[model samples]
Target: MKYDVAVLGAGMVGVCVAIHLLQQGRSVLLMDRNDAGEETSYGNAGLLQQEAVRPYEFPHEPSVLLPAAFNLRLDVRYHLTALPKLIQPLWSYFRHCSPRRYESIAQEYGHIINMTLACHQELISAAGAEQLIRKVGWISLYRTAKGRHKGLRTLDAYTRQGVNFKVLNGDELAEIEPAIKGHHAGGVHWQDPWIAGHPGQLVKAYTNLFKQLGGVFVQGDAGSLKRSHQQSWQLRDHQDTLLEVDEIVIALGPWSAEITARFGYRPPMFFKRGYHMHYQYPAGQPRLTRAVQDSEKGYMMTPMDAGLRICTGAELGLRDTPSTPVQIDRAEAIARKLIPLGERLDAEPWRGARPCIPDMKPIIGPLPGAPGLWCAFGHGHQGFTMGPATGKLLAAMMTGQTTDIDMSGFRAERFKKP
Candidate 1:
């Protein structure tokens, strides 16, 4: 059977893309090697992050870089073997972190970030996924007064861009999140973001909405995709053609490059590995009222249906590297100093990769050399938060409509002439 479009990832991004295309009068098939939302979409700190106006930058400071070089920090770790392959993209990432370039990039990124809530709100309303979302924004904790002052200043600058936030004294923070142990200074209560109590379930709800809207989702592989002489894209399983489509969108997240490489659009996409594990608080200790991120400690503690989840900082490891969960332990140790996170919920931590481009922006438009082929990936740490926005922009581009935001910055051809 032939379809108008097939999206090749069933994660939050692909599912939303299919939903949007279907809404725009396209017969779309959402394909993936695994179930929807069970991969990278499942693992996140669970914030919609409307206040994350700035793109995550690689630290150019010597004080931060020196310790991180030795893997001494809890927030970042790297795989020694991955460095050789990562040199080029990592270098570009560093270059883009320069103040002037990063500032310009953040302006463009904020255009997308600003739309995240409206986009996701539309999906949540359609899917009836309101129960999975907490409108109460997360809290950012700081230990030292100096850190709090600097952080508040940075946040104050963001406020001029129309972000909403509240400054909390140490006591106020303690009053709101009583379980957190000690804090000398204060924190920023980001009042604009939404927390996904269960990020994976939220994706499933959207997928269910896709099914209700008559969008097809199936198990398929892009590795088996090809353009027939008739100029149609076909997905295969084993020796049989699973389906054929006139157009295909590669939204395979971290694995996007592998397939795009075959089509001559391999972006300099590197992976940042992160881990999370749930823990039950001891009796009498209050559970997390809202998601809280300890900026100084480089971890996030969030409350969800499963339990209180402690998420680790970024690990600059190869995508294919075996799971190294050392960060979870370190994060848990750091968290216990503040809050009482009791027994571990899962024996093994959940790990996922964040697909990052050197310029700290996602690619979300047509594949240059490959006609009838589109691309959307490289959302980095904010994919979970911005998936719907990305989908909306891509679907509009795919259907030849004016997008909500400018599409030039996110084109797949930005890396090279491809």
Candidate 2:
């Protein structure tokens, strides 16, 4: 059957897009190679960050850059082979990290981030997935007084954008979370975000909601998407016609650029590969009430339904690079000392890429010169947090309605060369 629109990629972003379109009375066929949220959306720390106003930046300081360059730092790593392909976009990313440009990007980002919590809440309430979420926020553990001061300084910037956080002294921190023990100077408890027991299940809940609302889902290769002479978007699965639609949204997360480039829309994209693994605690071990991030250590231990999830920092490399889980190994060593992170639950670590663009903002809205073709990936680290907001915004843009936030700077054409 001919659908009104086809959304490629059934990750958090794409699923949300399909649901929003379906709610707007459009016949949406949600296509993905894997089940909804089974890919990058599955293996996150599971925090819906409302305080993520500032985009993650490249290290400008020589001390930070030098260690990261040699792969000495656990928070950041790079492959020697991936450097050549990434140099241009990485350089652009560096330039955007400049204080002036970063501030500008944050302003645009905050506009959308400000709407994320409410958007997700609306969907969660509708989907009856309230049991999947915990309103309790997360803690940022500072290992040193200097690190605490630096974290506060960074947090102060977010506070200007209305982010709420409470500073906890060593004694107060220990009192609140007795399970946590380390040489922590202090902690900043961000009181805005929500914790997900299972990040993938949350996506599935949303996807199920979409299905209940009459959205169609199919397994199809988004890379093979094409436009017919009649200006309709056609999707195929091994020569079997799956869908024909008036519009399509490419929300394939890390793989989004592969489809966008085919239509002459090449977003200067880079991938930040992150690792996470769950660990089983001993029988008598104290339970963590929430997720705790080692502020200086580039890792966070989140209490999930599965176990305490230890998530590592960014790895700059090709998407299909061999698993060099040095950060996971190093972060596990640090986590075991802080909390009771016993034996690993998984045989292998889960790795996924954050689809990052050079300018530190996601690409939304329609593609230039490719009418009826839209783009919705490049969310980087905040995809889960911002997916509903993106869905709401993109749906509005697609339907010619007013968006809740100003969506001028965020569009696929921004990356297109003049």
Candidate 3:
């Protein structure tokens, strides 16, 4: 069978791409090895971060870099073995984090971040998944007066950018979340973003909406993609059944680099692995009404459908390497002091790799020199947040329509050497 486009990933981004293409009267085949949203899309902090105007930058200060480099920090851990392979991309990432370059990247990234809420809203309303969404935004909690002061300093820039936030003191923070038992200094409640109770379920809802609108979902290996005699792309499904398509979209998240490399396009791609574990509240312990991030400790706890999910920060390692969940262990220790967490819901920690680019922008456009091929990956931490917006942009470009925003900054050729 033939399709107008074969989206080679069933995560949030690929599913959104398929939905957008289907809406534009294109026959889309959404293919994935696993079920939709069960990968990186499943185990995030579940934040649709509208207020995250700036992308996360590499810290250059000795205070921050020394600890992370020497493996003395719980927030960021790097495998010494992976450093040899990762140095090039990490250096580029650090170079991009220079104040001048970082500002430019932030402006470019903010364009996409600004569109997240509206795009997600459209899909949420269309898919009737309002029950999964919570408008009460996430909070960044600080345990020390010095940390709160630093947070206030950071807020000035966001405030200048018109990001909405409420500065809560220790008393006010306690008032809002009385269950928290830490001697907290304060918090910054970012009011622009939305939280998801079950992020995977939200993606499933969108997938169901796509299927209802005549899109097809198939289990297939995207690595099998090849150009056929008729200049169309062909790939075999799980049953080894061949399927062909006129156009193909590489939205395979962290796995996208493998497919792109096969096509002789090497965009500097890296992955930041993270882990999450859910815990239920003990009897008489108050339930958390909002998702909270322990800013200094570098972990977040969200009220998930399974239970209170404790998610860790970035871990630099090979994608297929054995899970070293040291961050989860540290986060759990700190989280226990903040809130009463009872029994662990998941027997094991769930880990996923986030696809990232050094320039802090996603590669979302056509693959240069590869006709009928498109690339959309390297979303870093915002894949789930920016999926719909990116899908609409990619669909617009594919259909030869006017894009809603500028596409120059997100081109795939940005990483190319002159």
Candidate 4:
């Protein structure tokens, strides 16, 4: 089979890319080893994070790093065995977190993030997935006065960036989210981001929309991709059939680095593994109306179609490492105090990796020196939020049209050669 473009990954980013390209009248094939949205795309906090103007940065303070060093907190944990491999990237991450560099990165990041809602809305409306979304926005809850004060300081920065929010005191928070039993000091109601009721379902809807638009999706090993004699890309499918395309896009999320490395390009890439599990609501307890993140505890409890999902903080570990759900366990213990969590819905927690770069920006353009090739990944925590926007940007670039946002900071050549 032949196609105009082959998108290797069926997560939100890859699916959206194929949709946009198909909209451009391109014959596209979207392939993934697993089902669509069942990996990293499936297990997010389900937030569209329109207010997340800034990328997550490494904390340099002694108070923050000291706990992380001992792994005493749930928000950040690292595998000792993974340290040697992570040092270079983490050091780069640290250097980029310096106030000056971080501010500049945030400005560029905000440019793309500002378009997230509109981009996703365009696809969601076309795909009939609006029912899966809630525009009530998510909240960041602080448990103590000190934490609340710190949160307010952070809000000042976001406010300056023109992000909309509401400051809620303990009483106001209780009135808004009567289901929550905690006596929180205060909360930041980020009033722009939307929440996904069922993230996986939304992705499926988008994929279905792609199919309806005449795009094909198949199960295949991206590792099977090779350069064809016709100077196109080819990959063998699960049925052992060859598929060829004039152009290829690697949007494989955390595994994207594997394919880029095969082509002799090493972008500074790493993964932050996280875990999530759902729990039923206790009898007589009201359900949470909005997704809430325990800002200090490093977990987010979002009401989902299945139940209330509790997602954990970052775990610095190898991509294929065995699951260490220590953060989930700790989160659950703390969550029970804030809300009445019922029986565990899943037998085990779902684990996925967030693809990250040291500078905390996605690499979203043609691979340097590689013609007929494009790449999009390294979204970190905002993959679900930024996918559609980046997809539109990638499609624009692929079609030789003016991009929706500036792509200077996200180029693959930004990193020093590895």
User: Between prediction 1 and prediction 3, which has the larger lDDT?
Assistant: 3
Location of the lowest summed lDDT over 10 successive residues in candidate 4: 409-418
- lDDT by residue for model 3 (1-418), tens: 9999999998899999999999999999999998898999999989999988889889887999988978988878988999888999999999999999998888888888888899999999999999999999989998999999988898877876678999999999999888789668999999889989999998899999999999999998898899999999899999999998999999999999899888778898888999999998788879788999999888889998889999998999889899999999899988887899988889899999989898878999998778899998999988989999999999999999999889989988786555
**Candidate numbers sorted by TM-score from highest down:** 4, 3, 2, 1
Candidates 1 and 3, the one with greater TM-score: 3
In candidate 4, stretches whose alpha carbon ends up further than 4 angstroms from where it belongs are: 416-418
The prediction achieving the highest lDDT against the true structure is 4
RMSD of each: 1.3, 1.2, 1.0, 1.0
Quote the positional error of residue 97 for candidate 1 in Å: 1.2
lDDT of each: 0.89, 0.90, 0.91, 0.92
Alpha-carbon shift of residue 60 in model 4 (angstroms) = 1.3
The runs of at least 3 residues in candidate 1 whose Cα sits more than 4 Å from the true structure, single-residue gaps closed, are 237-241
For model 4, residues 321-367, the per-residue Cα lDDT tens digits are 99999999999998888888999999999999999999999999989
lDDT of 1 by residue, 243-316 (tens): 87999999999999999889877799999999999988688878778898889778898898889988888999
What does candidate 2 score on TM?
0.98
At residue 164, candidate 4 shows an lDDT of 98
Comparing 2 and 4 on lDDT, the stronger one: 4
Q: How far does residue 260 in candidate 2 sit from its true spot (Å)?
A: 1.0
